[model samples]
Target: MKRNRNFSLLLFVVFLGILFITFSVISVEARKYRVKKSKPHKHQNDRNGNGNRNSPGPAPAPLPHYPTRSTIFDVMSFGAKGDGVSDDSKAIIAAWKAACKVSGATIEIPSNFQFFLKPITLQGPCMPNLVLQIDGTLLAPPNVGSWPKSSLFQWINFKWVQNFTIKGTGIVDGQGYSWWKYSSIYFLQKNSKHIPDMKPTALRFYSSYDVTVRDIKITNSPQCHLKFDSSRGIKVDNITISSPESSPNTDGIHLQNTQDVEIHNSNFGCGDDCVSIQTGCSNVHIHHINCGPGHGISIGGLGKDKTVACVSNIIVEDISIQNSLTGVRIKTWQGGIGSVKNVSFLNVQVSDVKIPIMIDQFYCDKKFCKNQTGAVGIRGVKYDRIIGTYSVQPIHLVCSNEIPCTDVDLIDIQLKPSPGYRGFHQALCWNTYGKSQAPLLPSSIDYCLGKNGDPVKRIEKSHEHVC
Candidate 1:
């Protein structure tokens, strides 16, 4: 009996030890998870609350203060000669730097004059409240060789600036037609014989906040018209960007690795997308704009190789497209692993568009893209109240053959096919809405195709279904 009791006691001690070990392990993991989850929010909140860095138990850095100015002409005491061949970039930079040192001042460029500016960077590290008001035309240097080269971005950068406003009724001409011509020639030559080198973008903005670019006409960009990376609280309004439709890679506005951005009341006519958002962007709102003669708004060609990119919480509404290639599109590269979720498109009006609505997951360009592991697909995209009058197919949703699309809702979409087209043309719907026909107006559902040409599905028309 004594021996048995001793054995039982030993077993009990072992059980206790195992339980303690498991409990300790679980506790440590839980604490670690809590810390991990709370750290980002804590840091974000601290930055928002304190307006700067977040050091534990210490006072945060004071917010950078900039003086406010009523007019840009108050700080301009110098001017560059209007000779077309003279380099004005250095003079402009010097004047801007001096004005930035003075609080709340405007650096003005007067009217009735033309000046040639070389590729120059207008940086704002210690200055926040400087306004660059141009009432005159700022022309680009004639020679493309005068532009500098950098590996960080194709264009020169305006970095880490805050409260900066570039507003005026002036023109900033990139004089980019020559550059575009050269690039085309280079590409054509390379295609015939060898691989050619890539060129740089026109304008690149990095790590800037509270930036407002308004009321300007920008023309003839060499590469992308405007690009923003890792910027927050950026508002682009009342601007017009125009390049020749044949201009290659002249995207109007491209956003990558950014957050909290809004683009409104703008017009874009370019070769590539009117606005393309790629990789690591969130909380993006694009509204009240006109896009045409270009590729439409896009999401990705994301996650090539081991690189991972995600886009979330994007809204595109109140947009008008005229004679564009595709109006609203979401494209993802094959063999990429990322989720694009909570995207909403509402009140979009299309006229004379090719593919008005498209979600292409098998986006492989440049000599028949091949993926060994199959295509990666998109998740959780919703479209409501999209009306398209198309010369071609009204809506085209092509998912990957392997991983098809899921959670797609299209409501109150009215497509009026162009004359000489077949009656109620092919609306390619696959792996979407799960064997349910879209809610359409009563008069148009008799010949509609749903889920591999089955006819049991009927359109839904509730009074609340009117878009």
Candidate 2:
């Protein structure tokens, strides 16, 4: 019995020893993570050389005070009604005028309030570092007839602004139903003598520099949702642009003559192209974009009306286009000059898309599209890692016969036609010279590639580009 008692004591001592060791290790680890000492002398050895490493510390020092910047100009204070019915254009103008003069000022449109505004221009070469912080909803006029001629092109235009940023968690509602009906009627009228100009885009930036627009929800634009014209160093990220699929000319984001633009992590579903990179654009990087129920992103529709369009150094990667008409296309009208070069589209995911890849030189929507000789030069184009399921044609490469595409390279391209469509998927090629280094659907890649002793183009319009 005594021996058993001693055994139990031994066991208990061992368990206690284990627990004590574990707690000691934990204490050591906890001591490793330490806060800075307020009194430096306390970290040193005590007079008797006891472990003073973790002495009873003094109270923590107070946090240093920072200078607060109270340069926020609230739109409500400018006599703007937050109601959805009142016209707040003048109030917005007044607030902008106040904020534009102060350096590093933020013009805030607070949350939960809908400000109804008319067409207005926010002209600025404002003091350094201005921010248009939008937290409330901004609604456009519902009737097109009520709009003036001055607002035909765009509803809200930011002109000549530098070092500007418009961002917030809010909505810019275009109320585009009326404009869509107007455009549809105008386009449908047979033998109509005068075709009025295109409808207004929602937000337009003209001749602006160093602009960043992000985290905003924009919807129902009458024409193009967002347009950046003659701007540089523009960044658009994490925005949602949406409209009905049947709406006409409602492009999500359009960039013309803009340079150094980065558009990433955005979702778009509009009538027209999700992102339209037009003529005179350069150094554009677009990635992580999700587009659907709309025309996929495109470069050109350029060279229209026999004009010169020069674009270069563009990259589009990691894009997904679902249920769209076209994906990753470059289109230019006939009878034009200049070139599109050094462009790359990589890591594209296409699902239920009509045309997965296209480069057209005869891009026209007019009923009587004039066929001409002059064409835009296309060179140094690359398509890589483009894997998709095409609903219609897998590929369409219709370059200009006069100025054939050159140095075009395709690699890692795997496409298959979607089920329920047994139309014998095709890849049509005309006047397009390119090297395909990857496998394609149906194993008939020679049709779209001027390789494997394929005939060089002279001039044959047997199959015009399928839009």
* Alpha-carbon shift of residue 185 in model 1 (angstroms): 2.7
Query: How large an RMSD does model 1 have?
Result: 26.7
Error of 1 at 95 (Å): 1.7
Model 1 clash pairs? 67-104, 72-106
Tell me, by lDDT, which candidate is best: 2
* C-alpha lDDT score of every prediction, in listed order: 0.71, 0.86
How many Å off is the CA of 187 in candidate 1?
A: 3.3
- What digit string (tens of lDDT, one per residue) describes model 1 on residues 1-467? 99999999999999999999999999999999987765545345453464234544446679999986433442235557756566666678777777767666687877776768766677776455778877777786544566554431444457777888878888777777767777767756876432225555666788888888888877777777788888988889999988888888778988998999999999988887899988889999999999988888888776676356678899999999877888889887766665676788888988877778888776776777776443444555767777867777777777655556655666777777655655336676554433223555323332332343222111111111111
- Worst lDDT 10-window in candidate 1: 458-467
Candidate 1: list runs displaced more than 4 Å: 1-76, 150-156, 191-196, 374-377, 419-424, 433-467
- Per-candidate total of colliding backbone pairs: 2, 0
Question: Which tens-of-lDDT digit does each residue in 268-370 have in candidate 2?
Answer: 9999899999988999999999999888989989888877788889999999999998999999999877778899999999998888889988998987887
Please name the candidate that would achieve the greatest TM-score relative to the true structure: 2
What TM-score would candidate 1 get against the native? 0.74
